[model samples]
Structures are given as C-alpha cells and as structure tokens.
Target chain A: MSAAVLVTAVSDNPLEDNPLEQEKVSLLALVGELDYTNAERLQHDLQEAIGPEVCNLVIDLTDLSFCDSTGIQVFLTIRKITQDRGGSIALTNLQPRLEKLFHLTGLAPAFGIQPTVIDALKVFRARQSSS
Target chain B: MTGDHGQQWPIDEDLTALRERLFQHAAQAGMRGERLDDLLLAVNEAVINVLEHGGGDGTLSISQDDTYLTVDVTDAAGHLDVRHIPRKRPTGTVRGFGLWLMSQLCDEFTIQRIAGRSRVRLRMLLHRSPTGAASPDSVSGDPGPDESWARSEVRSSPANGAGAHVDITHSGGTAPSPQQS
Candidate 1:
C-alpha cells in the first residue's frame, strides 16, 4: 500500500490586515510594505492617525512581513508621540522572529506584543480596567 | 586650496552632526533591524556619556569600508565602565542602558581600553539590501565598549529610557531576506 503525499506551505503575502473601521482600540493596521520603501508613509500615517482623543492605539502587524530602520524609527517616534499624548499603545500578531528581536533588545517589557489580536485586546482591557 | 585641518565647525555640535551623517550613511548602506536604530541611539548615548561623564571634546569618524560600515568614536569618557552593567536594577540607574543599547545594535562591537585613552568601534556589515544583519566578527574586542567608535551629541528623548514601545513591521519593503530561519 503506497500512500503518502507531501505538502508545502507557500505564502507571498506581507502579513497584514485590511483597514477596518477601528473602534474601541483605534487600529492602525499597516499593509503593503513597511521597510525603507514606505517607512516615511508609515510614520506619517501613524502621526496622522493618532490624536489627543486617542487613548488606545492597536497596531496590527499580522500581515507585515518586513521592517527596516525607517520602520523602526516610525515605531520609536510614534511610541514617543503616543506617550506625550498620554495614550496607550500595543502590538498584536507579531511574527516569531520579530518577537525574538524585541525580547533580545529589552523592548519586550515596554511594548505589549501579543500572539493574537484577541490577546492584545485583553491586555489593553486589563490595563484600562485597572487604570 | 589651503591645508589647515583643525576646527571644522565648533566641536560642540560636531558629534550630533556626525551621528546624523553616519545614520544616513548606514541607512543608505542598508543596515537593518535593531542595528540601525540601535546604532543611531547608541551613538548619541555614547557621545553624551563622553560629554556628561567625561566632560571632554572629541571627534568621531565613520566610514563604509568594504564589508562593514565602521564607526570609530575617540572620546575622553575612558574612566567610566565602558562594558559593565549593574546586575541588579537599582531604581533610576540611567548610566547603564546607554552602553547596553550600544551592545545590542552592532554586529562587531568593541570597547577597547587602548593606550592612555579609549576607542569605541562599531562594525555593521554592508548587507545587500536591508532587513537583516550579517554575521558578527567573532574576534570582537572589549564587549563592554570599543576602546574606540566615535562621538556626537543630539537633542531627542533618552533612547534607551522613557519606557515606550510602538509596533513595527515592514509592508512591501526591499529585497527580502534569502533565508527565513
């Protein structure tokens, strides 16, 4: 009985989500590419999306596949801006490698990188509830 | 066409200018991930350490040689612990993370306690298209702080401090990595 088949996983997508009507958490889901190619746009988008009223900003990276210095700068810049505005920021669905980078750099404790959007939501809710 | 090489702008802002120039060069050289951000932030921190800690004026040299874009900061902050980190986090210890962040950014980073002075050197590979860092030079010298890299001062938030985190992901960026391990 010869019965065996092989399977391979293929994904060309840049891990991201479509722009949904962000509420409760005010999502700023970045799609396309997030490296130097579009990092400036990412920074601009981030700054524009954030306002004094926005207390919670959830950046969904489930669809992202790449990141460069510009992208990192955007994150750093936005994070600073968010703090200055007295708001909370969280990350959801970060890839494993990205997760490791965060941990190794001692940034894990500063940013909430959750496995899923649902998990991020929980963390955000808990923070809100307590504060 | 004269040859006088001493004061090229006031020594005060030179470090910040040097940092920005190198950052642009590194970005152009295609250094990625924590390396780029880490280099920029760490350079500033290190330079400020020189200024605030050592209270000395210095010049930093940055060049993109064949395999790596080198940063050599020659400053007077030789007395401080260039490589040591407090094992236990005492509340409000600001001096540690500047050097700490520098360590995490470069592939081949060194803090050499050279003759009479210190030389902090940072080497990041000339990666083809950004996104990932190349392998580190195994023979990295003083892991604490290169006895030499180079210096500058800039205005901004304390990079390693402030306790803020923002999510980052590259969308349709440049040349994707050859391997995804």
Candidate 2:
C-alpha cells in the first residue's frame, strides 16, 4: 500500500490578553511519510492552517519518519506565503534524516529550526519584541 | 559473499514496504546509519519516478556484489529522454529535485532503453572500515571530482535483430559541491 502522510493542527493560540504576546501562532504536526502521493494534501493543509488572522506558525516534525523532495517543496511554498504576509514560520524537532536533507539542499539556514516547540515560540516572541 | 543475489518486486503504492525491503538488504550488507539512509532514499526516489513518470506499474530489482549494491527500476514504457535530466531546479521550485537527489546520493546512476522498456540503475559502493582492510584499493568513499564514474554513455548492438537494442547513458558528472546548490 502507498504510505500516507498525516497532518494535524495541534493548537491555535491567540494569546489575546497577554501583553507579551503580539500574534497568534498555530502549531501543526506532521506524521508518517511525505512524498509525491501526499504532497498536494500537505500544501492544502498548510494553506488552511495559515489563514489571514493566523500568521505565525510552528510545524512540529518530531513524528515525521519520512520526507522527500515534495515535502521540501511544501515547506518552501509555505515559507514564501509566510514571508509575503509579514509573518514567520518555524520548524521544531526535525529528525536527523530530515536535517541532513535540508543541509544537502543548502536550505538549512532558510528555515528557523528549533529543538522544541517552546523554543520555536520563543523565536517568534523574540522577533515580536525586537520589532 | 553469497555469489551475488537479487530480488525483484512489482511497483505499487506501498512505498513504505519498498523502502523497508531495501533497508533490510542494506542492513544485511553491513550498511548502517547515514550510509544506509542514503541508500534507501536514493532507491526510493528512483522507484517513485518509475511509478509516476513511467507506466503506473513497474518492477524494482535489487542486487549486490562484494563492492557495490545496485538497484534497477524498470518500466514497460520506453522513449524516455535521458539526455536532459536537470541537475538542479530553480530555488524554491518543488517538483524537479527527485532525479537530482538520487544522483547526489548514489555512486553511479544510469538510464537505459531496451526493447521499449526503460530502466534506471543506481549503484552505491558498500561501506568499509577506516583502515581500508576490506578491499584495500576498493575502499568506498566520497566521490571526488576526477572520478570517471561521474558520467559515460554506452551503446550495445541489437539483440536477435527483433528491434531490441540497448542504449545506456550516464547521468551528469559529479554533482556540484553542496555549497554550490
């Protein structure tokens, strides 16, 4: 059977009343495999997750066991979208294999990668305070 | 050690199973860690190409010798233009990196057309100890610029005169350094 990729929107936190938080960040987690068979689905899900009101995003890839060129493309597309909207996206908990891929393709510095979701959120928080 | 053995499987949507099988063989051959992951990823990309661009159905055959592990993915359809395989796509482009990635990961990659069938062959050198005791001069290591295995083309005479011919073409020369990308 063809391997399927699972995408889940874990949480969307607006932090409306908090003085320290300026933007709503949504967390999405990808699991299983990502390849040509499910690349389009991932693109759609990412777009749906990053609506107008929800800009800052964190994608948790700790559970993603497999990813291919198509998966990389989805990440690139989302990065473009986030940049165009004056928002940012960070990735957390990348498997070593996935990390190798980004390194090989010369994209390691393009994505904001963190060791944990909280660290990723800190990145956004830092950016907000600096701006 | 077993005089070179091979196994074949029909192409299907079960990429996970295919990857698992390839991993099993690589592990059996004493490949581990990053090297094993590279082998699996290269083969996975090639097989996916066969299923998507070639006919929906194809076959994957894997064989190994003492020095090299090889995989051949064949499809019934032919006439694939292997000359212009791109080494890299424009930055931020999504769909064109499969072939390039496969080339980067394998020691040698070739495409051949025989009797209306197209086969993509990928070869990776087996790992050896740092001491180079396994094969001495045959110690498999990172590909270098002067390596002749970078690229070549071969043509064989038709078999049986039934319009069956083999035209083999190598992929591009050594991949650019990762920094070039």
Candidate 3:
C-alpha cells in the first residue's frame, strides 16, 4: 500500500551527495548537507524521492560534514511535509556538529535523531507493520 | 582573472576570486583535488566574515608559502570579536550562516586587531599536487587546526614574514591621509 526510493550517497558537495535521486518512499531517503546555497535542490530531490507510501523517512548523515540555518530550515520543512502526507521522518548517524546545531536551534526534541541507520530502519519497519 | 575587480566588495561575494588566487598559488606550489575545494570553502567563509563585519572600505591581501596559504581581510571597522558564536538556529531566518560555517571549517583560525584594523587569518595544509582545479564556489571544514596551525607555527624564520595586511577607510575617507599609525 506504499511506494519508495532509497538513496545511498557520498558527497563533498554542499547540497547533497547525490543530485540525481528522485523516487517515492514506502521506503527511506538518505541525504546529507542541506545548506542555503542548495536547500531548494534538497527540497526538490526530497519531494521527488519521498511520499505517503513511505510511512517513515530515514536520513542517514554519518558522513555529513556541515549545515547552516538554511539547512536546518530544510529539516523543518521536510518534517512538516512528511507529517502532512501521513508519514514520519527519522535521522540517524547524527554527527556531533549536527547535534550541536539541533540543540542550539532548539530543535533537538522535535527530531527523531536515532543513533544509527540500522535503528532508524528498524523503527520504520515497526511503523509499517503496526499499520 | 575570475572576478569583476573593484574596491569595497563583500567577502561572501568574493570567495571565488580569493580562492582562485589561492588555487593558483597552491597549484604552483603543487596542490589539488577535494582538499583544495575544502580549503577554499574554509577560507571563503572567513573572508566573507571579514568583508561583511570586519570593516569598511577594505582591501584584502593573500600570500602563499612553500606549504601553506595565508589570507588576510582587513577594513577600517572596529575589532571583530573572534570568540566562537554558539551554533543556534537563525534568529533572522534570512539565511545568515557566514561566520558559523567559517569557524566550523577553519583549522587554525584566528581573529585579532592589528594596526587599527581587524584581521582574520586562516591556513590550510597542502598534501596533493595541483590538479583538477577547485570549483569557483564551495565550502568545508573540521574540528582540528592541523592544516591551518601547521603553516603558521613555523614562525622562527630568518627572513621577513610573508606579506599580510589590509586597509579600511570610512569616515569621509578622502583618498586616505598618509598617516603611518
């Protein structure tokens, strides 16, 4: 009863590691780095890659190196987007810098920052089975 | 050869130009690849801060030694507080991430007041041959000062220090009165 896209990415680019991924999620979308210079691209890619079929979205960022306020805004926007579509989002491998960013911005509690990609995927599967 | 040269341009806007200069030097000294891009990002953010907040009516200078690249941005503004600004959500919500990213990316970052000008100097180490020249736009950093600090640490030189200075003029800057203060 759902659809999805799973992105495995690597990046030295500020916007994302992969610029060509576009799919729906009864699945997870793993992305890294969403800065002002590239937030729109991230949004477009995310929207194109994610959907209601994917009950839980997982963003793996163990390899992520940076983010600014614009990047944080992207997170808020995506969270709201997933919620409206009757789905959820989870972030794993949260780097120390990213962790500090979340706390500084008062968004730590609002995000489901898991410890690892494995945990995030497990949670999503639980959600899928429960429904 | 990459920027529209003029006086009083913001650093955020001139990162690519400044970095082009860096890449040229780094290449001659044999630097290349993602490392160059990373260095550019770190330096660009810092330069942008200098351009935007460090002073007014300014000219920045850049120099490269055998192993390190030195960039100085100065203007006639009051001394900038170099202390780290805690990472927090944007208060203005208008995309102000310049200084924050600079601090995150710089290795041996320092901000100080010198000769009536604010100076921010950043260094990045070179470990690759100059090839696949850096893109005109990009930024990156880490939690260590190894790259930056290494270059600045070798200070017991027998000769003069590499050139580093900037001039900023504001209050009716009548073509700058020649006053050596």
Query: What interface RMSD does each of the candidate structures achieve?
Result: 16.9, 7.5, 11.4
Model 1, chain B: what is the TM-score? 0.56
Poorest 10 consecutive residues by lDDT, candidate 2 chain B: B155-164
The CA lDDT of each predicted structure is 0.50, 0.69, 0.49
Indicate whether candidate 1 or candidate 2 has the larger TM-score: 2
Per prediction, the TM-score for chain B is: 0.56, 0.68, 0.51
Could you estimate the TM-score for every candidate?
0.43, 0.76, 0.43
Clash totals in order:
35, 2, 13
Give the lowest summed-lDDT range of ten residues in model 2 chain A: A14-23
Which ranking of candidates, highest lDDT first? 2, 1, 3
Candidate 3, CAPRI quality class derived from DockQ: incorrect
Native-to-model Cα distance after best TM-score fit, residue B113 in candidate 2, in Å: 2.9
Q: Please state the error at residue B128 of candidate 3 in Å.
A: 12
TM-score of 2: 0.76
lDDT of 1 by residue, A27-78 (tens): 6565543443345666665666665566666777766644433345567677
Candidate 1: tens digits of C-alpha lDDT, residues B1-181: 0012111221243443555566677777787655566566556555655555555665566665445666766565466433242222222333354454455545545554445556556656665323243335533444333223332111112242222122112222232231211
